[model samples]
Target: MPKPLYQCRVLVTATSYGVHDPALKTTLESQVGEVVYNQSGRPFTAEELAALIPGFDACIAGLDRFDRQVIARADHLRVIARYGTGVDNIDLDAAREKGIIITNTPAANADSVAELTVGLILALARNIVVADRETRAGLWPRLQGISVNGKTVGLIGFGAIGRRVAQKLSGLGCQILAFDPYTDPASGEGLAHFTSREEVIASADFLSLHCPLTGQTRGMVDAAFLKSMKRGAFLINTARGELIDEAALIAALNEGHLRGAALDVFTRQPPGADHPLLAMPQVIVTPHMGAHSDHAANAMGWGALNNCLAVLRGEEPENRVV
Candidate 1:
């Protein structure tokens, strides 16, 4: 492929692509005019990003905060290609106001995330993590586990990952209930029924959150939400961590109102080693590996790169968000 007429400088803030697969990095480097890898292992602070991004023409955004202050400093930035689906971390309004094109690789990691959601549900239902720990310690005690078969599972979001979760659970004879006002009820292929959010919370034996973190959804699952759930019901969140109040979750579990919880995302990226949730025997936690599968990482990296390059080349990108 020949270089575009105008070669634009690119800053890749997502650090995992090179580690996941060097070919992904290579593909990105070959297309863009210039590329800068994030030297820091983690996401850049607003101050750090603002200073680093001024010279770059496009950026591959990760979980970095691109607030108004940061966006204001990006004098030469033309596009922001988000490495993942959720763009809540980016200041979309600021980007829009600056006339910077924003794009995300939606559904690029759907299969991986959806699979992880089902895995969490199964782990919580069957006490897989608990059982493994005990057996490893030489205490071979059998524990009672709930079966998902014939049980109803509620999905709070009916997007790509939610639909895949329902489809996967249907094979296990699990009934699905979905609560997303945006999706049509008939689109669930008879595997799930679209219903009121309140109904799903009260009726389902298991409730899984797959909704995006928006102004409407932030801290949505608080005391009231937990109180409305069926007693001893299980909760699974593979979506945004800010959706559920961590304090409310702890209280619900302690009061015996809920059985167990499985979390893939946390309000904090890395909860402390001695975090209360980590010490809980009933709770299962994974370090946000919902979209860490090799296939998903590769697709997301490639998509983010191409979307950014498209804008640099003055072409319309498929995944434009702003």
Candidate 2:
């Protein structure tokens, strides 16, 4: 007789209880036995995650810390499905050593995040928030905003999202410049690439960051880097927060070296209410909502769930991180 389908126990960490509209639990229940759900929003501590992962055959994870210790404790963990593209939160070496498949949902939220990046660039260049506030207060503040047309836009990365951002900006008549060591000449976007970050910063009228945060990129945009930018140039970061030195950015804005800046991510999530960046009129900050749009969230959920199911069935799912 044929063997019955493998009955698995699953754990979901760092997700909203009702965030998944159709609910991953409902979907997984059809294929697995007994699913445990947790809604710890932010990344969990190593100890906390370790304590919660025991006995789960599979896990759908968010930005929770999945270190070697945590993976070691999850004796039954067969697969880990990440809800987003970034797998920096997961310990890839540990998962690989344990023969646990690690996967993420890449491109599920590319359009949403790319759209947000453009919106941020516009907002920073135009002082949209400040103008709206003044107008709402019954004052006709004639604040002059910079024009994007005829400006030079420098993109720091040329990945899926970065390429899309460049395409969108190109339609706005902005000259596009990029600085990516991994840029493929065959991609054929016709955008010019600079050999050095300094060259990009000095030449572009607006700088947009689209690179991942790694050992080389962390704190790469510091005071010296900011000072090298064209006076009155603008900065936009929708990628990783740690990529920019917050203190250096603040100082540059205060010194009038930069016209303005926009950030959708932060080194610290939900930075203190009194964060200095919040107090600056020229700095626009969003609560890391780059990929949080409803459409993006739903797409991410479905993609992650599908990937998990594929791995469970011993298929090579797309976006496998390990």
lDDT of each: 0.89, 0.82
List the lowest-lDDT window of 10 residues for candidate 1.
1-10
User: What lDDT score goes with residue 267 in model 2?
Assistant: 86
Report the CA-based lDDT of candidate 2 relative to the real structure: 0.82
Angstrom error of the Cα, residue 37, model 2: value is: 3.0
TM-score attained by model 1: 0.95
Worst 10 residues of 2 by lDDT: 1-10
Cα misplacement distance, residue 235 of candidate 1 (Å): 0.4
What residue pairs are clashing in model 1? none
- What TM-score would each prediction reach against the true structure? 0.95, 0.91
Tens-place lDDT per residue, model 1, 1-322, is 3235247688889867667789878777777667899988888888899888887888998888898898999988899999999999888899999999999999999999999999989999999998998999999978999999989999999998999999888899888999998888888867799889999999989999999999999999999999999999999999999999999999999999999999998998888897888888889999888888888888889899789878888899989999
- Expressed as tens digits, the lDDT of each residue in 1-322 for candidate 2 is 2112257777777465237576655777778767777755666777998998887777888778898999999887778998878887788888999999999888877888889999988887788999998899999998888889989988888787888887777778888788788877456256555547678889888899988878899999999999999999999999988999999999999999998898888888778898999998888888887888778888888888888787777788887888
Per-residue lDDT value at 99 in model 1: 93
Error of 1 at 121 (Å): 0.7
